[model samples]
Target: MAVDSYDFWLFDLDGTLVDAEWSYTRDVFDRVGDRLGRPFSDREAEVLWHGLGGARDDQLREWNIPPTEFWPVFHAEEDPQLRAEATYLHDDAAELIRSLHARDRPVGLVTHCQAFLTGPVLEHLDIRDWFDTVVCCTEELGWKPDPAPVRHAIRELGVEGEGTGVLAGDGANDVGAAWNAGLDSIHVERHDPAFRGQCVLGDYRITTFRDLGQ
Candidate 1:
């Protein structure tokens, strides 16, 4: 199917459309490590920040860090305003989103980013209105790859399940969630497959939104 053929669209925020500066990412990890009394090398920080190694909990386990102990400190160390200032949108993503918004298409955001940070980033970027619905993954709604959050966004958009819908993201979890919800998936490969240690298959794979002829 063509990109414009979808009845509605859903996207992942952090890596797919926008990303934080490396300095900010590094600082966050530094603080996390300080709090945990465990120092993370630059490579380890990069992998965890971009989820390059796949599931974060699994990576944490491999590093011998208790996920239960790591997450709270990680979230606590992330300052919303600082993060928002450091975030930037991909040009291709911006063009595609603006085009979709101009056409009055239904677009939603489903992200692992918490509500507090998501709000600030959207506001700072002045693109909050681009999305008709924003679904921040939570314990209650469930995370991506589980389909609950994507389904929740679909419900919020008031779109029918039978209509062709597509979800795009830069992670395996996004593709999994789309497939689980019976939607086509777009894998936006923001990082090299070799660096990720695996290729995330999707209905469509591209390096950028331009590959879809946005």
Candidate 2:
């Protein structure tokens, strides 16, 4: 199948386009630990960050901090730093986006990450103009797996037709979100069991962006 066959492409930000997992976690844990008067190590940060998934409420529960207290502290400390360190992008990411755009394929970004976090990353990467629409959690529509945000992205891109839209992501929630939105999903995995059975649920599974053509 040709890439243009997909009228629009929806992508997850973190882990899919940008590598913010380490830096994001470090900041979140540092802020949470500071507010709780506890020590947060990098290792601990990893655990807590991965636990966040696409659910904000669950993350708050894991950190044992209310959103009110958590947001203030997190914004005060981690936000700026995360924005700074999120300059890096996956190899060939820019080329891929450019190619997609050249083909007149509308590209949209739907991330569970809030605007505060995605804003800096987008600026740092200097690819903000690449996307036709961005649906972040801060926008109030809803998060991934709910499908509302995904559907909103599709609507923004004005995509229509069977298999004309694909949601490319790196997690189970991404898969579920695409499924719920009635769009084909492409799971990107860097290693074995990157998504386990989750990848099986996707219409396509690729180890790299290049596989999209195959």
The most accurate candidate by lDDT is 1
Task: Provide the overall lDDT of each model, using Cα atoms, as 2-decimal numbers.
Answer: 0.91, 0.72
Q: What is the lDDT of candidate 1?
A: 0.91
Query: Would you list the clashing residue pairs of candidate 1?
Result: none
Best by TM-score: 1
lDDT by residue (89-169, candidate 2, tens digit) is 888566678889888788999987667777777887788998999999654687778899998888787775434688888
Q: Give the runs in model 1 whose Cα sits over 4 Å from its true position.
A: none
Runs in model 2 deviating more than 4 A are 21-24, 38-44, 47-56, 59-72, 160-163, 191-200
* lDDT per residue as tens, model 1, 64-170: 99999999999999999999999999999998888887777799999999999999999999999889899999889897799999999999999966577999999
Q: Give the TM-score of candidate 1.
A: 0.96
Collision count for each candidate, in order = 0, 0
